[model samples]
Target chain A: MKILVCISNVPDTTTKIVIGADDKNINTAGIQWIINPWDELALTRALELKDAGKISEVVVANVGTAITEATLRKSLATGADRAIRVNTEPADAWTVASNLSEVVKNEPFDIILCGIESSDHNGSSVGGLLAGMLDLNFISSVSGLDIENEKLTVQREIDGEKEILETQGPVLLVIQKGIAIVPRIPSMRGIMQARTKPLQIVEATSSESMTETVQVTLPPEKGKCKMIDAENAGEVIRLLREEAKVL
Target chain B: MNILIYTETREGSFKKQGFELISYAKALSGMTGGEVISLAIGEIFDEELKKAADYGASRIIALEADQLPDNRNLSKLLIQWIKQANAQVILFADNNTGKAIAPFVAAGLKAGIATGITGLPEKTDPFIVTRKIYSGKALAKIQVKSHYKILLLAANTFGIKNDPVVPVIERHNIEAEYFESPNKIISTEKQTGKILLGEAEIVVSAGRGMKSPDNWGSIEELAQILGAATACSRPVSDEGWRPHGEHVGQTGKVINPNIYFAFGISGAIQHVAGISGSKVIVAVNKDHEAPIFNVADYGIVGDVNQVLPKMIEAARKIKTE
Candidate 1:
């Protein structure tokens, strides 16, 4: 069974997001792009499964323009067998999921992995939308996944509980953290192989989005933090009770 | 116009989220000139079904949760109800369940979708709604081109308003063969807390600055005095110092409590993203330059050992006052 990891190229987590002068999108100038933290972890887990011989292939796919290839190259360097980039600017979750569904159809993969949400947009919808478009079974918030003797068992968080579920057939998992300990760093040999590895660019199935971003702006500025002296530390409780009224 | 809200219940009873969703839908109805219709799936007790109307639900419908085995069936059932009620807008709580299911419903309806909606539409003419982007770092105004709109709301973002209305409640049964699924559940383990972290009005969280798990007792003592929930950074939970259920961050649960207390946490953007929704934040960290202070409303530079004890002592005085 082949596994496909849906990846998104997003700004590094540390970047302080600012609206560009365009006023409708985030400023991309001098923004360092990286594989979304969750998606990178997803790709890492896929490779782990492949290394364990539980899956035959691990493919990293994305929906973005040519500039996205840099992040895809990083995925390739991290041990993804190949990479597929659908040519388009990933505008919204609807467009991204729709276009990626077409790619998944053309290249059959038994298990598909997606992050809970991208770091930049935090839409948290692509995997579900993609599952609907393909009419596939989707499991969300899957923190643990194991396949043994051709049987798949999943541990999912629901409300305040952890529920164990067993499932089979083609499955799409929207995974959060804990599926993998940490993202894999590229090895020297893997980095060299990534230079010549297959990175396929395909036309997007659709460019339309159901939603349009009309304006982008920063959140309201917060008040300066009041510094309380260490000797007066207990005063905070009085302030929280009288001023903030939270206690 | 008709608005649909999928109201969630816990253990056969309505919770804070259900009331919040109903109240929000009612507010939306005023703008859209629509009637609010609430849909309760699963096994909600009969009495709780009636209170949904107290928060402004004009009508309520109950569907057996077992009939719809998975999210796919749940989405299909929602689609069926959307058409039946002629609902142009569907609302869902942006918790774990909503995170998993709302996108599928949007796909079926071919509607524009927005998650973590913070406020009402700035204007209804173009159907624009505002939500947090970049995990609460920024805001985006989304224009829904499609007539059908699916919105996932973070509970408590919209305050619950009590505008009581008489509701028509009905139980609708699904066909036996709506879906034949293969997934089987094995077991479930629920870790109940003194206060459900998501619903807590105040939260007290700590990170590596605590130095050791043994120091967590002070954090809990403060929380007990304040009637707040105890939470920890991801690394604390990952290290087995706390259960994963107590984890609060981008990878864990995101909450919008009335107030949040951070002790010794450095406030990485990921951790800050989760707590930024709180009404107020107070940080106590030894590092003066810790990033958590950037967003905190108040800051204290002191060691946890010294500061935490003072905090606990002061908090114990709240009841006496």
Candidate 2:
């Protein structure tokens, strides 16, 4: 089996997002980038499938500029057999999906995996859009996955209920967290080997973006927290009912 | 112009977000001079359809089917409706079902799409919408460049309004193409009678500071007393102290409850992202400097074990009085 995992580089979870002076983009200076946490889990699961001999190869794909290659190499060092970088800064979910569809059309892969949504944009559109473009089966927010005899059994959460689904191969799954609890760390030897691994850079086919970021602004600062004495916990309830009016 | 609002239903009842979307669409129609049209798929009752009208739908379309089609098939159905209705704008609740199908529908229509939208369009001429980005840390004003626009509204962002206008209901029997899903839901498990965390007006959440799974009894009791849903931080869920369904964070469910109470949670960025939409936040933790206090409207530096019981008692006393 050949599995394609789509990854995105996003700001670290703890990074304080500062709107750039242009008012349409984030301030990139001093910002630490990492593989989107959800995508890292997806990549980890794909590698586990490969390790179990259920998949022959795992290829990591990203749609970004040259700077994204560094993150793709880290994915390689973590165990992806090869990496594909579509040379374009992803403008939106539709653009990313369009570019990925172009790549998937040229590659022979049985399964495509992606994080449910990119942490930065939080747009959970790419996987579903890609599946629609390819006319393939699509599952979103998958929490569990198992493959046997080319059939896939997936688990996903919906409205506080869990649904276990079964589907055949050639499917795209938008994985949520818990597919794998721990992400793999690249070893020294693995990092050395990743340098020898193939990193293919391809031009993005679609330059059109459906949505444009008109402005970026931080949320309004919350009011000062009213600190009540710990001994008077009941006062919190009274304040919630009388003052906040949210009880 | 026409605006299409996809109304979601469960067990023959309209979901709360359905009414919220209708209310939002009605307001949008005021700005665009568009008709508010709501589409409901699967078997639905007339009364449930009437709820959309009461909320503000000008017209309602009901598509009856025995079993609900999967997202792939549902998107195809929506595309057909969009073309037939000549819909310029489409709206959906940013729930599991909507998140799964809206993207496919947008791809099919080649429409500009925005998900997790928090407010109304900043501008309608070129169609600009505001959505939370960076996991609710910042807001982005986005311009839709396509002729057709799709939006998924975050839950509780738009308040529901009922004008009780009588709407024209159109019933159509259309045979939708169904895909053979390889996956079947073998079973579903949920805590009966408990409000779902996503839909709850008030939520009481815990974190690793609660120490052990056994201590959850008091937390659950507190939630029960307040008539609120229960949630936990990522570490609490990861450690098996709570079900993953109850996890609220960047990786977990994003909630917009009216009031959110966090106990023993040290407000990690990811966790804060999930609850940032709440209108009121209260945090109780032993650490005075826990990051949760930064976003909280109210804070109590105390042991959750002591604070929770007192709060629960107070809530119960207030209820009985």
What are the TM-scores, per candidate, against the unseen true structure?
0.96, 0.97
Indicate the docking level reached by candidate 2: medium
lDDT of 2 by residue, B192-293 (tens): 576878778899999988988999999889888888999999999888888887899877889999999999999999999999999999999999999999
lDDT of 2 by residue, A1-247 (tens): 8899999998888888898999999999998889998899999999888888888999999999998888999999999999999999888998899999999999968889989888899888988889888988788878888889877888887656777888877888988877998899898988999999999999999988899999999999988999999999889899988999988
Any idea what lDDT model 2 has? 0.88
Query: In model 1, what lDDT does residue B233 have?
Result: 92
Error of 1 at A155 (Å): 1.2
Clashing pairs in 2: A165-B183, A166-B182, A166-B183, A166-B184, A167-B182, A167-B183
lDDT of each: 0.86, 0.88
Worst 10 residues of 2 chain B by lDDT: B176-185
Off by over 4 Å in 1: B66-68, B238-240, B250-252
Could you give candidate 1's per-residue lDDT for residues B41-160 as a string of tens digits? 778888889999889998899886653457777788888998898999999988778888899888888988999897788777789999888878788999988889998888668888
Tens-digit lDDT track of model 1 for A1-247: 7889999999887788878888999889889999988898888888888899998888999999998999999999999989999999877899999999999889778889999998888889999999988988888888888888767888887656888989885889998877887789999999999999999999987988999999999888788999999878899888887998766
Report the lDDT of model 1 for residue B47: 88
RMSD of every candidate to native, in Å, equals 1.8, 1.5
lDDT of 1: 0.86
